[model samples]
Target: MPATPSTILVVEDDDIVRMLIVDVLQELGFSVLEADGSARAIELLEDTNQRIDLLMTDVGLPGMDGRALAQKARELRQSLPILFASGYADTVEVEEGMAIIGKPFSIDQLRDKVKSMLGI
Candidate 1:
């Protein structure tokens, strides 16, 4: 039997960027859940019983930033893989065991990074 597609929770404040990421992840055969900010993302995380394989979020977000969100998410789901997307590379530091993809990344780059993180 084939394994189920990994579910990724994407938290991006920009609408266009979030749409693009969702489209790419869907096309790449992974299930995607999108949120425009940290609050919504946390709501989804708290409400879902399904297994989420990854959390891809922007470093800058309104209300609760991505780093705070990632920390909260890890509390909810231990050792959840995270990919922090940021346009400001100089300000963003990649955490241990967590992945970071700069903004304006190509579809292949996003797919490759997610695949490597998920061990797909």
Candidate 2:
């Protein structure tokens, strides 16, 4: 194992879902940060001391949705990899160095997606 595990920031509005995702990532041996919305996510993102290897977020947030949050996150940390979890709505468009995972993903799928995004 590497000296330090990669860290991921996960943003989702649902508390249960967020816990489930964080649990899986922890089982996979990654350090994770959780935020229920963009406001908290921005706080974590803006803290330069935090080491975030990837961002995985739900696209449909209450305010300051995931896409906008991602834009802001990019402004704070250039080249940070981002993954969006959407229900596959037609409106969600992924940009370069970013990816999207459909909602209700299996644990294996989530694991694969995160690892693929992190290039592990």
Candidate 3:
């Protein structure tokens, strides 16, 4: 059987980077949702109609930051998977089981991480 399409929430403050990641995922045939910041990303994840298979967010964000957002999201949905991406990923501490993709990533890196997280 073919795999189901997974709705992925991408939270990034940088428009270019966000678009790049979205383009890569879309090219790989995955469903995508975007949010410029943590608050908006939370809104998408909390939407009853949306079933987010995974969340891919930048580590540095204005106001709520990605770590806090991921923590809060974990509280709301324990089964949700999260991946953090940043140029300064080493500076940010994250939980176990959560993956981190460094900035300046290749399309292959992003695709592989998403696939691993989604267990594809």
For each of the candidates, the C-alpha root-mean-square deviation to the true structure, in angstroms, is 1.7, 1.2, 1.4
Name the 10 consecutive residues with the lowest summed lDDT in model 2: 88-97
Q: Estimate, for each residue in 42-85, the C-alpha lDDT of model 3 and write its tens digit.
A: 88878878888899988889999889999988987897899999
Number of the predicted model whose TM-score against the real structure is largest: 2
Tens digits of per-residue lDDT, candidate 1, 41-116, equal 9888887586688999998998899999999988887788999998885677766658899888999999999988
Which prediction has more favorable lDDT, 1 or 3?
1
Query: In model 3, what lDDT does residue 64 have?
Result: 96
State the C-alpha lDDT per candidate. 0.89, 0.93, 0.88
Clashes of each: 0, 0, 0
TM-score of each model, in listed order? 0.92, 0.95, 0.93
Q: After superposition, how far is residue 23 of candidate 3 from its true place, in Å?
A: 0.8
lDDT (10s digit) by residue, model 2, range 1-120: 367999999999999999999999999999999999999999999999999999999999998999999999999999999999998745688999899998889999999988888888
Off by over 4 Å in 3: 1-3
Error of 2 at 81 (Å): 0.3
Cα RMSD, model 2: 1.2
Give the lowest summed-lDDT range of ten residues in model 3. 88-97
Model 2, residue pairs in steric clash: none
What lDDT score goes with residue 92 in model 3?
68
